[model samples]
Target chain A: MAEAVIEAKGLVKKYGELEAVRGIDLQVAPGEIFGFLGPNGAGKSTTISMLCTLLSPTAGTARVAGIDVVHDPARVRQKIGLVFQDPSLDDQLTGRENLEFHAFIYSVPAEVRRARIDQMLELLQLTDRASSQVRTYSGGMKRRLEIARGMLHEPQILFLDEPTLGLDPQTRRNIWTHLNDLRSRTGITIFMTTHYMDEAEYCDRIAIIDRGQIVALGTPDQLKAMVGGDVVTMTSTQLDAAAEEIEKSFRVTPTRVDGTLRMEVPDGKKFVPRLVRELTVPVDTISLRRPSLDDVFLKLTGRAIRDEEAGDRDRMRQMASRWMGRRR
Target chain B: MSVETATKPMAADLTIPVDTRAASLRAIYIIWYRDILRYWRDRWRLVASLAQPLLFLIVFGSGLSSSLGSGTLFGARGGLSYIQFMYPGIIGMSILFTAIFGAMSIVWDREFGFLKEVLVAPIDRWAVAVGKALGGTTQAMIQGLILLVLAPFVGVKLSVLTVLAIIPLAAVLAFGLASFGVMLASMMKSLQGFQVVMNFLMMPMFFLSGALFPLTGLPGWMTVLTRLDPASYGIDPLRRVVLSDSGLSSAVVDRLGLTINGHVLPIPLEVGVMLAFGVVLLGIAVVMFQRRD
Candidate 1:
């Protein structure tokens, strides 16, 4: 469609000896909602930081709104709105004051600033509480306020790093609805990062990053289709014998994972019954299910996406490096 | 939620194109204005910060006045007393502590996560630093003004003209000192680290400044260090202005005056030094902010 709003070529970020984002390449078209899906420490935030002009890439180049992030970061900053993973709102300021601060810095003209702010507050359903200090708002309200602030400047692309990370499930869904609504109304481009497999379903396209590289990138349905038909999993005490028996009998390899034998077939319903009847080994239990985003992640990354503790540790290491960098 | 609450048409209008220069100026003003507004909202912080200047002016000034024999004659009767001699020092101290600590607001902002809001703005980083410095300067100057009420009790004279003269110098000193604080705070990222810096760095700065005593007759090394301390330059001009109107003897003024190469630093020169100090430190702070936080 339109020329990419955000384009990067082999972008990399290094903190001393550690490479947070090894080498990332991405492109987001105008009006597209793109999501970077990864477990914690997967370089989602790092890549977003480079695109937002908050960090310098160590080994590559990136362009946002056609302005080079490194060559002219100040201009790049003007064209993009960012809602960082961390809580970045000024709690001391009212919700309205917070939006006003963003508007002023982005140089929203005085003539239209008040109207735009009122519109944003009303859009976020914060008009009634706009005058109260931000610290008094609940966590969900704060996230919504941040989203309102991000859209206040009318940037070409909005970057949100883990926008719903710490929110309750209901709040998460509400934010998703608002994002979709904003996209429909303005056709604004959204580039966000999330670990939630379900949330990735909302994006037009998803990039699955593991370690420091994109393991897979496609629409949610397309990625899930890669897993094909249906999945059949069975647990038995003689798992190895059963796996061998099923493979030989059906001519389909069964992979043993977490003490269970899993195999994919065109139709689990047709395959499971025949396998159960034909199998020579006794099975304790068997189940059939459709493939999900989590299963796709598992198949691509070779592990589950529940390593939140790794995420915490990775963040700590990055913060420490940042602090040490400040010293130099 | 009502149907009206559904998302309305948005992102359709003209988003303002930043006039870089004008935006920079606005950035400075809004950031400074925010600091002032926040301080106004927190009354306890304002009242609590007043304690340091008062304790120094009354307790420290009075106790030392008794030990130094009311600062006359090396006790000359009816001459300027020790409390009077250190009055400017107390005001300078007030500005020093308040302005410097005020700059530390950035670190608190960092910890609380609000600093990212400022750091990521499209405007110049210098604007942010300058705005923060101005905010801290205004607050420091106000604290110095608050101590002016205690001047009469300490036996220091104040006319409208005397106060008028003190205001600009104090503001300059506060801006310079606040810039210094902003510079330090920008390099640091933690409040606990700032507490350590306050003790080790701020204590020597106040002590070395002639706010408490004259610089004459100190060890050679100590004299050089005091001369280098930016706080001394700030305290000197204010000292000159306060003792200038007091009719204090030439001897007392000479003892309390800041000197370079044995010549007393003129008021204009002291103000120039302070201005230079503010500019350089704030420049460094701008460069620091330019680096990714």
Candidate 2:
């Protein structure tokens, strides 16, 4: 297992009375694309920050690249690269200048500094725009520049917080291609956090965190398999009547989420036809598909991935913690 | 997609043979250099910073100098124009304002998240603090030099040697205020919060530093304050350099200078106070930064 590039046990971070990360234990093998998937304020970033040495855990220890984070954080910083959740580029500087500044600060060797930056710039497809100020960059380009800066130091592990966050889907896919290419070429371990459920498919393994604890952890297929079958979804104007009639006839209750009745059937394709012939109420729409990570999140967490009301409450809590001088 | 992984044992790249001391020094220089690049990039900011000092030197200095009617305030020298006396004050004010506001970059970084990137760097926190102080000092010193260009127009002249001495002295003053600003800004979270705190601390420090008036013959409490103010020591040295060319007797220069128990404070001594205060304040700032995580 390549000595576990990152290992955490019972890691917890607290802000006064509120705990951002309760007790987490995980590890990633060398060259693994491990994802921490959780909604906002679900302790994804706090756990990442602890591993990156930006924040110390209240209880427990994490070791990155064989160095204990708490005991010798500076050495850990030397071995890891981080892309902040927020855009951290000095947008005022040209892309090449930004990379050079990072190279110097990270103490990249003078002889090879220019070459390493040039290589990263090319790897990210930012070579032609290298002399342009980051402010002139498109969102995806800026993110790519950040990724290049993160890798210029040639660290063993790279931690990206929400790598595709706030990017258009097309751009997000573009970043994914770049990341996969980076891993195949250098075999650098990638530890990233993202709330996008579909995005978890790109990871080799994922840990689903919620309310400061890991609810589930596994590869995407393994976690989806936990839901047991294909998912069937139906939306109707009269949800109450449709839910009653379907349960009465089929004896299989469908869960209600966002005004849609969802049921997991052994054979969703066959079941959808029977339901169409037998259901009493008129349905607006009905669909059958394989279980997604969102269904997995729903099954484990009892709420959909894009749980807006809960998200707002979590956002308020995060803001309060930040006001108290803690970063989530 | 299959990774086909070796994790490519980055052995050649990993062992760069680090000299931690050299790395720390380079980190400091890069951080300082980054600030210099940003300063020049914002042309409006560069021009805007000097505007207030110019307004004070031309409009406020002219207005006050005429109202006081030249040397009426300085009974001893009898030839010191209000503009000449206030010239160094305006320079101190410029440095003070620029240094304090320049520290806002630290707060901006915090609010915008760039600070976290720098904080997580392998370098020591004190290096970052020192780099920031140097950056702020350089910006303030540049503005102070621009204010110096206004001296000739105000009818005050500087010998080549006076300008030479004033250069480092001006930097020292800027360094002191910059350190003080870094100390204040390190503990603050938002730019608005920093602005409020700076205004509260900055206005009093500038006004009470005896920059606008002579420190001698002040009321007891104000005299105590001006003595305690670091800018008082900083500006008094610049005044001593400028007034040195006035060919005033040492008695008049001493009267114009800051006095404790009727002994005029010497340039080396005043400079020593400013230096010590800046270093201590900078130490506090570094400690604040270290504890921030």
Give stretches of model 1 more than 4 Å off. A13-23, A58-61, A307-328, B1-17, B70-78, B243-255, B291-293
TM-scores for candidates 1 onward, in order? 0.90, 0.91
Model 2, range A120-213, lDDT digits (tens) per residue?
A: 9999999999999988999999999999999998888999998887788999999999999999999999999988888899999999999999
| CA lDDT, candidate 1, residue A35 | 97
Model 2 deviation from native, Cα RMSD in Å: 3.8
* Model 1: residue A56 alpha-carbon error in angstroms: 3.4
What would the per-residue lDDT of candidate 1 be over residues A57-165, giving only the tens digit for each residue?
9999999988889988888887788898878888988999899888888898899999999998888889999999999999999999999999998788889998987
Error of 2 at A226 (Å): 2.5
DockQ of 1: 0.52
RMSD of each: 4.7, 3.8
Second chain alone, TM-score for each candidate? 0.90, 0.91
